[model samples]
Target: MAVSLLCCDWLKEYKTRHRVGIQIRGTVESISKRFFTEVPCVGQVLGDSFAEIKSLGMPEHFCEDELLFILNTDKRKSLTLKYYARKILYFLRQQNILRSLKTFLEQPEEQQSALEGAVLVDQYCNPLADVTLEGISVQLDEMVEKVKKTLRLKNPSHPSLRCAQGFFSSKAMSIPISLSVLYMTLSHKLGLHLEPVNFPNHFLLRWCQRPRGEGNEKSYQLLRDSLDLYLTINPDNVQYLLLQARLYFHLGIWPEKVLDILQHIQALDPSQHGAVGYLVQHTLEHIQHKKHPVTPDEKRRSAPEHVEVQYSVGLIMKHKRSGYNCVIYGWDPKCTMSQEWITTMRVQQLSKGANQPFYNVLVQDGTCRYAAQENLEPHSAPLEIGHPEVGRYFSEFVETHYVANEELEMRYPEDTRETLGKVHELYHGLSLDSGHQDQASNQPNHTTNM
Candidate 1:
């Protein structure tokens, strides 16, 4: 109860000073730019993102400035690779959903900006439909207190069932932090005076003094400088570095800093050198699977002559050869079938049968099969694809079209691209200069951080 009051009061005072939380609204770039400038160390988050990628053996030198290229470029595709670069770019980008969050917080109306951030990942974009600002404040305060009581918080990814089910995975829990910087981004945006503390193995968010502006600024810079120094003096902070390295590995992302940290750990304790070093190397190769690429999915394809003819996943169509209604859910660029079928379709063109794309579909009665691209047509009849599971997999089942799930993840069999992965739901197409496109899209466009 006391915490809840404090939460409410703190918010009230913050809103009183700002008059409106206008700062919360903006495109992710705009918000991040402001956030990095205003909040501490957040500017380096783009570079730090590679820190997670680096552990998986991804190069620590992944480009930082190309983020805007993705924001500005048109969607390009490669029929040969069956890959969409824009989708990967979009998968990694985030919009500041803070405008919605700000309104949800009941902050007074101020000038609105772009409305986007990195913290607003693909999932958890929307708040529970009926929740209110004050209601969420009370709940957040309670949860924060609960977390404080246990003080056993762990990094995300391999989170304990309690934290996952209780806080992040549960829509009822009010907020989620897919990344630590996300929580810090939003907390500081809300004037919470929160700071990221490098607690031994994991990270923690703690309150810092706000009244002492100059002192706080000095101390914050000093703290940041010390971290830079420690990371530079690699041997001194091996354990802390190891904790971060392993943390990203568990989260299915790489942590390159792990290399620096690992070298020191192995050198200081050679007994661990062989085992730990080998395992880290194995994980890196596994994550960056160049050895077994199913396709050159990185290739981009502009609107080739028949790009529109290529049915998107979740598109309803009719199998011309079989004369059956079906929905297109996947595509296979090459066929990998057993001898029995190879014997049956001996005359089938190798381009379609052996080494070109075939449409993977769900038939009317609900079984999956691959049909040649030439043997399919856009369903012209006014019949609904009533496969019972259609509703389960698609966003909408309109008579004329199948609305794809907004968070639909693109996966291929070999798990190569799936390792490094692509961008999630392409909420905004290259038409991205207009962020309204995202809000207007069918995806649940709610926003909250930590």
Candidate 2:
């Protein structure tokens, strides 16, 4: 197809340019430093990553910057996330994967920079195993075309496409925020010096076009002015603002902080009063359960004295009775829900009853369940749970388990290490079994001795 040819040509040109040792833009070090210093929200999202970024100061590909960012932010020690990150970059360097960003790249460089400003949220929301840069580009292009068609139909006189509104209204159809992050990365490959702007309710990128030979202060001022003007002209809707606050909560920002924002929105628009109250109540419950959790020790006695918590966080478990896949994000020493709900679910029917440990799980069916320990089992062949809330509590999906994110770690600090140990032990046991079978097969028949 013509699209494939375009992809090949674009990749060839990009690789040729890369091989020439042309420093199109400054190293990722400088870019990351500038982003950290100028963009306070970025620093907030990725806490204390300055030291990590400083260590990786050498000039490298744009993808390396994102990989490092994801690794640092997630704080995942598992090799699975690293392996997949390396795999993506390897294919990029080897030109094994097609560059499907040809159309976006071919657009006017100015417009490309604008697109970067509109979709910089991708930095925090990194790509997953199923998310590919090429796939995102194709989707982004299709969305743009759709938006352009709508604009032409609605207002033919002024058909200037709005990047933020279009992409915001049109869902990515893949992993939630994959397209946004990949869009920023794809533009970075084109040598655009786009800096992330801390726009209200969203992350925006601004093209940093410094006076040919000037210091950062001047460019910073220009960016500030542009951001100010942009804000003044384009205001966010109340509904969008509420959604953004919810998004911040989902991304593991402080519950009190998000709640404050929601309350403020409610104050500004009385229409959202009821919705904000419900969200406030929901967030308060989340804070009580996760942020200031009562450890198993505090609940009854030390974990040794009371019922030993069988399952740790970040475990992929199958419901023995319900027959559905789920991943654990939290657990209580015993059932902590209301007695009414317990009676309704018939918790008394279980062998251990409501006294057994209960797990808070994100189910594949997009529902949250508090399953009893007796009803859960380790998945025989664990795969990633396709749940929308996976990003809220966990960061990386290891081979058979999920790696808890910082917020989840705050609640269950020991779980991440335990999950890693369990994974290693599982593989070690498998290898031992294989070795025994190999030895048995290698032994020759001693017919002469017999």
Candidate 3:
């Protein structure tokens, strides 16, 4: 969710006018032209394409591409649309945004997925060109199995169980709409076309069939078939809205479009029953607030870090970005990951005078690798450190921390202090002036580290 310009104040006036039934005529054509009249480039771009598809979400298997366009501090910076668009006041928004705007406009028109069609089909799923609904579904089912294996494989006896329902760890820990959203995303990415239809209970996919007499592939096509999958979602309004937001975020849906859908939802279900109306309103307000160029100074303040952490080798932790549990094996005071990863990370902006710590952990789904301190979080449940070579380093899991036995020191005494220091610094951000504590001592609380 990028910084937006349409806030509650703007919505307050707009909603008031709507409530009073004051219909404003004319398309956004006129509005965009008038609004961006001074900014000719922007006006023209808007007239051509209101918004571009920046990026989209991927299935768990494609987790690495989640934030596909990494926000580089040097390359990618953020400011409210106002500061840049309107050129307001001293905090002159960076020129990078203008560069991005130029780059965005310069991109091939085919990349503007929103303008292409609401009925989005993959490159391979062209009904007229050559694919059939049944054939697509068969292919989709196979991809679904791959998705299933990447996540929960077999169905649980109790259907409503969190794991059975596509939730990992627990209901509270994971996103509410994980299953259907991921399932639908994977199916779509695997060449199945989908769009929600008028019917409340049915989720449908629109497919066009070529006319029998048509000789040309580019001729006007007919809306001949729709692939309907029997999909049912529990009537939970808050979660439902959350899912909608996540899906829209994943699909690169524009805020204005989302606003229209929210308004439509309000009109469709006016009863304001079962939290749906409230959720809709809250989300609408959030969307509007995000669009606002002006933000209160209070919202700009960064909160202090509240977490007190003590980590150890053999201590199981979780990868923050990927949500995968990993076992700590080694640590690096300096950023010493792969050249690609290290370089990719260097563009990131961090707090002044901050140390970029690196942790060497083994991700369960894949291989052992290193991630920055900013990317690893402590895991609660004990993940039996399953790396076969665990015996090569750690002696025992004394607690949350592991200890290196006498055998390690006898073999490589030179490397012992470095290993211990890496663990110590990562766990406790302390000055060397404060005497280094004994590695074997389980006195995390007694020591001032906490």
Model 3 whole-model lDDT (C-alpha atoms) = 0.39
By summed lDDT, the worst window of 10 consecutive residues in model 3 runs over 222-231
**What digit string (tens of lDDT, one per residue) describes model 2 on residues 319-394?**
9998989999788887988999999989999999999889888787666778999999888777888654465566
Instruction: Please name the candidate that would achieve the greatest TM-score relative to the true structure.
Output: 2
The candidate that achieves the highest lDDT relative to the unseen native structure:
2
Question: Local distance difference test, per candidate?
Answer: 0.42, 0.57, 0.39
Instruction: Rank all candidate structures by their lDDT, best first, as comma-separated numbers.
Output: 2, 1, 3
Candidate 1 lDDT over 93-183, as tens digits, reads 3112333333433433333221211122111222212334456657867887676556555533334434533333222343333456688
**Which scores greater on lDDT, model 1 or model 2?**
2
Runs in model 1 deviating more than 4 A are 1-272, 279-310, 317-352, 360-399, 402-450
Q: On residues 2-106, what C-alpha lDDT tens digit does candidate 3 reach at each position?
A: 345543477675554443221111221123222221211110112112221112121211211111112112221221121122211110111222333334445
TM-scores for all predictions: 0.26, 0.40, 0.23
Candidate 1 vs 3: which has more lDDT? 1
